[model samples]
Target: MNLLHSALRLASAESPPPNLNGVVSTPDGIVLLGLRGKPLPAAFDMTQDGDWILPSSATTAPTARNSYPAVASIGRLEDGSTVFTDLEADSVLHLVGNRYRAAELLRNIALELGTSVWAEDLELIVVGLDPDLTPLGHHKVETFDDLRPALQRFTDGLDLSVSELDTGQDGAPARRAAGDPSDALVVTVLVVHGVDLYDERLLKDVCERLLARGRTSAVVLTSSTATSLPGPRLSVDEDGILADVEWAGGHVRAEQMPQDLAVSLLDVLATAQAPDEPVPPAAEEHPWAQQMTIDGAWDPELDEPEPAAEPLPSPARTTEQERRLVRVENDDPDLDDDLAEWGDTETPARPLIAVLGEPQVRAPGGPPPIRAAWQIEVVVYLAFHERGVSREKLTTDLWPDNKATSASNVRRTVAELRPWIGKHPTRPDIEFIPSLSTSGDGRYRITGHLLDWELFRRLRKRAQARAAAGHIADARADYLNALRLVRGPILSPLRNRGYAWLNNPDQHHDTLIPGFVIDTAHELVDLSLAEDDIEKARWAAEVGRLVDPDSTHDSPFLDLMRISHAEGDTGAMRQYAELLLAERDFEVGEDLPPESFEVFNRLFPNGLGRAVDDR
Candidate 1:
């Protein structure tokens, strides 16, 4: 509460606003503060206890002209959310204020994008009047000194191609648009607080930095009836407050930012992340529907006309478009350079065989056809296409208990499967899955098909090797590709739902599927952490949860611990500890592991702090 109180004191000292937080720019000083807690003015609503910030005269003094004492407090509400006091007041303010609303908005954006924006997409910037008034101290943006380094650190080693902008310059944001901004979402929030403010230049620089971006949403939180910066002025009635927003080109609009505002903001994010497998025809009428497209909204002026579908390419010929789509999304420039040494390598020609999830076969750039049980089983045996299975081995593996009648069943299944693969009505000569070959020993082999699981395995292996060699960017791309192939557990529907009545029952997964998924997830998380990618690490843990919902191991616990530590979220820490206790008891039939205890001890060596008492 100390930081929040300090900010409030500063705000009150400098003609405090009706509510908390605002952007102030004077001839001698410019400060941006987003405060929370309660309304500062009695005329304003008293029900909202949010943080506050103040504006002060510009000066380069070492000590503050006025300083507030620290406030100590802690507790929780009925809903189990913790209440904070002392320096922890900033947390309470943010959790209850518009800052929390902004975070929720970002999450909703991620959901809409079919990608994560957690820590992955955001770039935060906080401009405080007093250096000590850092919000949560999670990752503070230290004015001019911090902007470049912070932005560099966040974007570094990422696929994002940031433009070379002179961030130290007063108004350098315009240059940032030259680089590709799609790699990550950059959101900079400037919070200025303190009585004796100095170096007002950085405050202006931060606003410009955000303005330079082609895509950005800016909102000004203020309780002032008269805003210093010229912009749109909102009229918050007795129960409301002013939110004056001023953008470039004198474009300004103001509005009421009360609890109702949150609902409106949420609608924007929800619309962006609408679940559309393939956007419906009617959806096109909606303004946000264009966002669902792969390349975003279609541009009638710049974009080419919609092209008719071309027939799938044969093994002998490759179209340029087909080649591009067939190749995995490798984001690393360095990896491309490394691969260049091997000459002009093209996407290897291979038919798409999906075995990791439901067993289905589809040609490159073609739709997946429904496959029979035996057809899928045969394809699984010839996973790499180059491999072959002996007729006896196939029977034993397919139906060991029914060995007496296995051969006839296999023969019947193969005969039925041939027409679907060997002779397509459109291309009579093209063999999606070539006729099975009988070796001298009567072993059967299916040629010209590639299994998706095998490809996923190869990609994971390559990523592992690249990571070992310290080619992190290359490794990340490979890991992403590998993970993308995992739609569900290996051989789903058939193994999990479709044909459980078959001789080979499902639910009992192949030992390989679960083990492979868990291992790959761990590797992905580890690699992501090494690259300082908390969001990717978080996503990896989610993938692990999908595969091993019971969390048979400690990876999920460790992941939660790491996430909580990075965010300085004590509640998350408590949740992680409780989960670990339950998980460990179930898995090992013992108390939580030493690692879990170590984290718990660090978070609450003094009996779980006030958080435990609330429970």
Candidate 2:
């Protein structure tokens, strides 16, 4: 059932399966029908005379053959290969068996076809069978109480032109020629129960017409009584064994579905068919721009400079002679020189702890001799809360369920981690993690050390400042440095396992770190594009994509699309457009945003529909 759900989810986003004589092919071009017998089938020799290659031998049991037209497993061969049959094969398939067994086979086929990715364009017209398929919620399924109305409905839906239709040898109208069309052709499979009750002439006419139209197929549930329907007869016994399968050679046990499983499969397909909630419009603009700024307010002046104001005399200048002397003497060191000297001596060594990609502890010595996983988690937690966290808060967050020993657990963890973190580099007397009692306020926090996360933030802040000051090159440099520190998503090494506190909406590193990354990447992209450095722009966009591949914030994709457009790579532009469109379709069940559509339309004036048609 999980496999069925996965297949449905994947199939819903993709185009219909390529039509290979009514056989549904997976994305990998193989048809996975289901399991067969209890042992592996011997591999077929390549030197054999046959054009088709057989599956390789395996010592394992229940082998599934990936050959064509074999859409579902009916039974197992003596050699362990599955007996597959395409329920929607090109010709009409008449299932002759015990009434209940035949109906069960029909239900199984319906369920498989309904959930199959390859059958996206398949329309099932079920007549006279009440397997309770309404709960399936698939748009293609239509159940009728009688055969006459089902055939009438199927006939009325046909939209063939005069040139498209031709009289077959049996005088039934069929498709004249199979031409490659702009859209995928629909394959209608007419499933009928109790064929003897229907008018024989009506059944024969519909089957002939269906066979003439090469893309269509039919399956009829018939009693043991001879029926006028023309096709190979597959007999199912009361014991559920299928006999006289020409392709399968001998009889094999037929697959039947329990009513409960059919219902469950239908429910899952219904859920898969349900439309996804619309993605909110928040991602249309740069969501991170406001958050990445120094004052938490993005400045428009940073992007567009205002008019120069009237010049005013500097108050620091004494007179023209003093100003000239000051300029000539060059005795006073500028702010850049002073900051350079200070940076050379004051900038701390590489952060001892990193929470950017993996939660890592690079102690003064090679690797920290930390004993437990909790010790690393406690350090990362404290590092994230740079201001400091109280003993009560830390315990409650880290061990919410284990309250009685939470306080002691924190105490023990910090005590064990203290030695490994070593003494503060600048202040040797002060340990990296200060004892709770050492501080007047009983809050524990890391001191005299920086985390990679903190370093990234500092660099981003510097980049923001540089950009605001119109130092484009310097700002670009700072942004690149910040982005380099981001090896992956925040705390990716810990994943979702130990970071309970991270889920707190009030202090969410998940959103905060990615926001900074996206905003910085966008800044670099804009700077690079302004300088016509397409390679750098591409690098920045790719990095932004790495952080949020799902396009939770779609500005990164939009930036990439814009870059692709600039490069005049229409194919790449369309690829990005389709990705953005697919994301929107999955998340919001809607079209691309207007600006995004504009970019796509600019490249392909006829629209995405025409672009697809051209393909």
Most TM-score-accurate candidate: 2
lDDT tens string, model 2, 571-606? 787677677776765311123444554545444443
Q: Scored by CA lDDT, what does every candidate get?
A: 0.39, 0.54
Clash count of each predicted structure: 22, 1
lDDT of 1 at 321: 35
Model 2: how far is 207 from its true place, Å? 42
The prediction achieving the highest lDDT against the true structure is 2
Error of 2 at 188 (Å): 38
Candidate 1 structure quality by residue, lDDT tens digits, 313-335: 33332554333222222212233
TM-score of each: 0.37, 0.45
